[model samples]
Target: MATPKHDLPDDDIEYVSKTEMKREMTALQQLGEKLIPLDKKQLATLKLPERLFDAILAAKKITANGATARQKQFIGKLMRDVDPEPINELLNKLAGLSDRHSAWLHRLERLREGMLADPKIVENFVNEHPSVEIQQLRQLVRNALKERELQKPAKAFRELFKLIKQYIPEPALPGLEASGPEEEDEE
Candidate 1:
């Protein structure tokens, strides 16, 4: 038998299970699937290689089930040569601020503005969200008004927004359970 050619000992070679490799391949395929739905402009942002970009475009066009599966597998194989971290990071950044999330933030801003504009809005806020500490809310509002009058830093104003966030739950994604910090828990 031929002696081992390399310097490293045979015993030092780390082994990976077949199952782990398959799991990684599946994840890559799923990531590729996400890229497929994006328009050409969005795909351009990823700067994929010509072969991989063409493969993705072809995958988008295929309707036959078996052919689509094979194309997806090919894309997964191509993805193996690419660094997925940057792709995943970019995809996550793109996914983060959905329209719903933006609208929710705007609503919170409007609520804060309304409270500042009208004392009655504070009462309405308290009534709408009974879980909040009424005394703390009022104090924060008063302090925020005083800060505005004195031209001081808007510490209480920002704090009031934080308090409101703690009380109001973020809008849930469709078909998914709402996952945020417990509303009753004081931070």
Candidate 2:
């Protein structure tokens, strides 16, 4: 059998012992398995470096008196490289704030602004969906226009609308459960 080629320089190859090579091979095999289905674009977007990986691993190891595994993982990522003093102060200040739809409204404004920029696309959409409420479509376009001018991208707004559509109760879609007979009145 032919000798196996070492990609590294002779000096570097000599510096890495056989045990190191075996360990590296195992790591590569694991990485390949984890990454097989990810396309180049998805891989590029991960932005994971050695420091990020190390930070995540380190975060995973921190345990408090009653922290769960999921909570530890969440706090680890959220707290990584964050300063505690100012964050605590901010949290204290915002403690009274309710999780309302206001933030989502802001996001919707951003989406509206983006849609207005592409007039042709908007026109085409309207043409395609002639039965859709013209006033509603106009409102959507106007909101997108406002968001773009404010320098907020429309993605957040679009996401907010998508979430609303998904979560908010709607008149049942076609072919869903039919309205049944009303229950008899009890004494």
For each candidate in the order shown, give its overall lDDT on alpha carbons.
Answer: 0.78, 0.44
Candidate 2 C-alpha lDDT tens digits along 1-187: 9999878877765477899976755554333333323343332333444443444445445566355344444434444443333323222223423223234344444444445566665566557656655666666567655676788877445643543333222232122232222121111
TM-score of 2: 0.23
TM-score of each: 0.49, 0.23
lDDT of the structure predicted as candidate 1: 0.78
**TM-score: model 1 vs. ground truth:** 0.49
Worst 10 residues of 1 by lDDT: 178-187
Best-matching candidate per TM-score: 1
Model 1, 123-157: lDDT tens digits are: 99889888889999989989989999999998898
Q: Candidate 2's error at 180, in angstroms?
A: 20
Clashing pairs in 2: 107-157, 112-143, 112-144, 112-145, 113-143, 113-144, 113-145
Off by over 4 Å in 2: 1-114, 151-156, 159-187
* Clash pairs (backbone) in predicted model 1: none
Residue 69 miss distance in model 1 (angstroms): 1.0
